[model samples]
Target: YNVTHVPYNGLAPALTGIRDGSVQACMLPYTALVKNLNGKDLRVLAVQSKARLPWLPDVPTTGQQGYPEMDGNDSFVNIAAPKGTPEAVIAKLEGALQKTMQDAGVRKKLEELEVQTMFMGSRETQKWLEDDVRKFSTIIRDAGLSTK
Candidate 1:
């Protein structure tokens, strides 16, 4: 399929464009489209997660639709410090962050927001990112997408 990219300032405008028929489709977060999941006008073809989303259990995944290479595209948030930050401070922050994630209120809020929180320490996060870059680098290169 020859698809054209439709740029929008943000999710709201993208949703508007789709609603107005200015664009046929968009890649929107579950939060952005949750209100319309049961509406007749909006149709979700697939979710990019490896398995079905708990919130959208009826929606198929890209992998389930025979696009397994597009699986596990979970968005993440990262906290970072400058290069010379002390390891002791970093450890303290990591410990605090992990504790925060474990809090029932925090976990409940995250679940309500439809986010699957997977906490990783600094070393684990770094390793995951490096491995992702190597894996997607080849995919991007193969798809003729620029890495620059």
Candidate 2:
């Protein structure tokens, strides 16, 4: 199928376009669509994950919907510091972030917002970041997209 891609500056405007009927559909993080889902303004066709999201249990995963290739595109939220930041400082921040993610209040708020929290140590996060870069770069190259 030939798909025409219309670029939006950000998720907010893209979602607004969908709400106003200017855009027919969009692919966005579940957290960004939580309010619209609660308000019944949008319907989630499928999630691009191997398994269904805990918060949106009723929504089927892309794999479950017969699109296995769409899976493994999970969006993640990460906190980063400068490239030359000290290892000790990075470890301290990672520890604090892990603690925050484990906190009842923080967990509850994230759950309410439909954000899946995956707290990883600095080493794991660095590896994941490298893997994501390589994966996305390959995807872009395969699709003939220009980084410029």
Candidate 3:
């Protein structure tokens, strides 16, 4: 498919483009699409995560839709401190975040926003970042997109 990459200034314009039929589809964040999902105007074709989202139970993942390469394309929230931050500070932050994520109210709110929260400690997060860099860097190199 000759997909056109339309660059909008922000979410409002992009959403407007979708709402008024200026665009057929878009890759928007789950949080951004939650409220719009109420009407029949918009639909979620496939989630980019490796597994299907609990909030979108009926929808399939990109991998299931025959695009396994897109499975790693996930929107995530991370809390990072400056470099050389004390290990105790990192541990405390991680513990608090883990606890907050496990809270019923917080979990419910995130779920309502179609965001599935997964807590990854610093080590795991670092591994994920490194892996993501390797993955996307290869794609960029293959596509000949240079930093210049």
Best by lDDT: 3
Give lDDT tens digits, candidate 1, residues 46-101. Answer: 99888898878898998999989878766678898889899999999999999999
Cα lDDT for residue 48, model 3? 92
| Each model's lDDT | 0.85, 0.83, 0.86
**Against the correct fold, how does model 2 do in TM-score?**
0.86
Whose TM-score is greatest here?
A: 2
Give all candidate RMSDs, comma-separated: 2.3, 2.0, 2.2
The local lDDT score (0 to 100) that residue 89 gets in candidate 3 is 95
Comparing 2 and 3 by TM-score, which wins?
Answer: 2
Give TM-scores for every candidate, taking all chains together and pairing residue i with residue i: 0.83, 0.86, 0.85
Rank all candidate structures by their lDDT, best first, as comma-separated numbers. Answer: 3, 1, 2
Candidate 3 differs from the real structure by a C-alpha RMSD in angstroms, to one decimal, of 2.2
Off by over 4 Å in 3: 144-148
Model 2 spans > 4 angstroms off: none
- Of 1 and 2, the candidate ahead on lDDT is 1
Alpha-carbon shift of residue 53 in model 2 (angstroms): 1.1
Residue 144 shift from truth in candidate 3, angstroms: 4.2
